[model samples]
Target: MNNSVWNVTSNSNLDTLALSHSTVDFASHGSTAGTFATLNVENLSGNSTFIMRADVVGEGNGV
Candidate 1:
């Protein structure tokens, strides 16, 4: 996923979000209602951009 954008509007939740690529973009949706409990990222290479809010992480499985 290179230069990808995920728009989380409202009432959105994710159990496990796994992404393997050079670049991934959440469109800075860490502040909105969209959230994820677990994030699995693979292929840690060069020039990778993962924009996810801290509060949006680990917010799954009734956390």
Candidate 2:
């Protein structure tokens, strides 16, 4: 059986709510055969009073 894999290509945007449509950018890369990555809301933006969340999904397969 093949293992499930997930990775973060980039955050690239942390859509802010209080700043009238602002965003922050982040980036990461990794490898996995049966693992996943997660970026916390706190890591989204350096600015206080800003919030971010993600339900993103990624996949990988063997050749």
Q: Model 2: per-residue lDDT, tens digit, 1-63? A: 012222345433334323223332222243343333444443332333323333345544441
**How do the residues 1-63 of candidate 1 rate in per-residue lDDT, one tens digit apiece?**
344554443343444454444444454445445454334434334344566555636778775
Extract clashing residue pairs from model 1: 37-60
RMSD of model 2 against the true structure: 14.4
Backbone clashes in model 2: 0
Model 1 local distance difference test score: 0.47
lDDT of 1 at 2: 48
Which residue pairs in candidate 2 have backbone atoms (N, alpha carbon, C) closer than 3 angstroms, thus clashing? none
Q: What is the lDDT of residue 37 in candidate 1?
A: 38
10 residues in a row with least lDDT, candidate 1: 37-46
Q: Kindly give the stretch of ten consecutive residues in candidate 2 with the minimal lDDT sum.
A: 19-28
State the C-alpha lDDT per candidate.
0.47, 0.33
Quote each prediction's TM-score. 0.31, 0.18
Off by over 4 Å in 1: 1-23, 27-34, 56-63
